[model samples]
Target: MSSKALEQFLDENIEDLKSRGLYNEIDIVEGANGPTIQIGGRELINLSSNNYLGLATNNTLKQVANEAVASHGVGAGAVRTINGTLDLHKELERKIAAFKGTEAAISYQSGFNCNMAAISAVMDRNDAILSDELNHASIIDGCRLSKAKIIRVNHSDMDDLRKKAKEAVESGQYNKVMVITDGVFSMDGDIAKLPEIVEIAEEFDLITYVDDAHGSGVLGNGAGTVKHFGLQDKVDFQIGTLSKAIGVVGGYVAGKKNLIDWLKVASRPFLFSTAVTPADAAASAKAIDMLMESNELVQLLWENADYLKAGLKDKGFDIGNSETPITPVIIGDEQLTQKFSKRLFESGVYAKSIVFPTVPRGTGRVRNMPTAAHTKEMLDQAIATYEKIGKEMGMI
Candidate 1:
């Protein structure tokens, strides 16, 4: 822990990352990550934000937050197990449960924390988890933390999931088995075959968990992926984020009352960490209310996504098979993908490159996240820029 050793450690690791081209140079956004964002005093069409429905900057959400801040102050003051469970927090949880059509729901600081809190609370060393090979990092961490025997199921391959579930169940080595997957894969925009997963879970008497963080406010009339597939009653755990399409902060787990009650009492984060701020809770509730009141924003988001996808395909960019709005213009080379993203940024589009470690080697891509807030003109301009740069770089 000496200063010299710490410096040596930092220097050695950073240099190693740089040499491997895995060191990411952070970009400071001068303003909001809305349809358009500002960086270095220059504005660009932001195709990289997860603000799918554009509610992050909605005026109604802002007004609700302003009022909550004025009445409740900023911090939650204590952890939920103590006094941090404010009326606003309870209302937010209630609203989310209602939104998700679940008996109860519990909120957490982040989507990452939600996985950590929920998984470790339910599964332990005696239990086993059948997780998608492409599940999020948080899910992996949560599974690991639970001391569960983790089984990897091939991505979206129902047979693999079924095989793993059967194997884990038949082995009788673990007390319980849980099947977990991301409702929508962020990298590929592929939707999980949840109906098959649910069937597999039922056949093996396995617990079903869907992390619908990206699907909420974007699918199933803005309810989520499970709802999109009409398996809300069958899925045991439905996890979602108040961030992303809801356009705020925090995460939640929605399910049967008993499961939620268990989480409230057993989840470490809920018991130890301070709750989300009053402003955040109120704003998130308002956002959910908005999502329920109208599908105008969701409709716009899909329209934009479709428009962008069609435009890109026409221009000969290999946008991988994505069912959601997460469009990945596959470049197949890390350096070229980065250069492509840089060129787009220079031409007023803000998209980032996804390279190795984040993705498999030689499958690098520029991921574009189009929002409902974007205008047709903006999409047109972005497409034009893509065509220009793509050909200039001999990419198409």
Candidate 2:
């Protein structure tokens, strides 16, 4: 109520974060976050970016974005339902639908907004949502916003999912039921069991939603997890991001034409917020085209991941069971994990430490994102740095 009271409350929270070693101090990257970056005036081999396919600073995407800015003049002045639906937006949506092999698609300002828009647009107070325990924060928030009865299944625990889904359907306590999960668990890099989930969804008549934010441009030869598991038609809502592997900015929901149509009319973000800029839309279209054209970048990314994982494992670091390009060096204590990341940064590497409430407290880790742009030499340097730091910190 009072200024001092509010200030004290904020102070306590800040102290708590520092005490838990979970307080993150943002660092400014001097240039592009490519395979290498300049932070605090020091160049380091960067493993902290979501630029999986190395398309963030790509020349072709840059040129396309530049041209769009020249033509569209920077921003979409109004929301999609208003005056912001440019031809570029439509073209990007069409390309995304084709890439995801879906009937239609709708774009949002960010991947995070896509979750908020899609989930809340479909499921509401009268419905129930069965979500994965380890799904992204955006998914968690989206579920909360929907006012749905949230049932969190154990991470990748199909049996738990099946049991809950059966009970939810049999109870008939909800007007509708939906099951949502990330196509690839971000922290651990493990893929969702879509085949099993799809089977269970069919049995329970639950709507299937897969947020393939990390899986797009990385799985199914860059088509996404739905296509990777051949469940393209089975998954009711296939969500993806243009920000991650697509190497741009924006999010989308690819599904039946009716679903996209409904979202266009009902989703709050689509109706209230300005659409993605023409540059983002154009660049994203080109990124999708790149993924569709060849698997060279994807293959290279996997190879780099394998090399880094193997190297870290050989160095006696507990690299978790990651099936994708995301590799986590598990250091149980939050402070130790933070120290590890700092030391690595100081020694010319740029992987960041992830701690609760991002993950379980005891599972703090330095997550490495190996990209297609990383070379064998770059990874070797990172591995060597890890070994040095791990040994010095008695982590090995």
Among the numbered candidates, top lDDT falls to 2
What is the Cα-based lDDT of residue 347 in candidate 2? Answer: 96
Candidate 1 local lDDT, 1-396, one digit each (tens):
569988999999999877766677789999677899999889999999999999889888889999999999999999998899999999999999999999999999999999999999999999999999889999999999999999988889988888878888998899999999999999999999998888888899999999999899999999999999999899999999988998999999999999999999999999999999999999999999988899999999999999999999999999999999999999987778888998999999989998888888899999999989999999999999999999999988
Off by over 4 Å in 2: none
Off by over 4 Å in 1: none
What C-alpha root-mean-square deviation, in Å, does candidate 2 show against the real structure?
A: 1.0
- Return the clash pairs for model 2, or none: none
Query: Per-residue alpha-carbon lDDT of model 2 for 151-257, expressed as tens digits?
Result: 98999999999999999999979999999999999999999999999999999899999999999999999999999999999999999999999998999999999
TM-score of predicted model 1?
A: 0.98
TM-score of 2: 0.99
- When summed lDDT is taken over every stretch of 10 residues in candidate 1, the lowest stretch is 17-26
TM-score of each: 0.98, 0.99
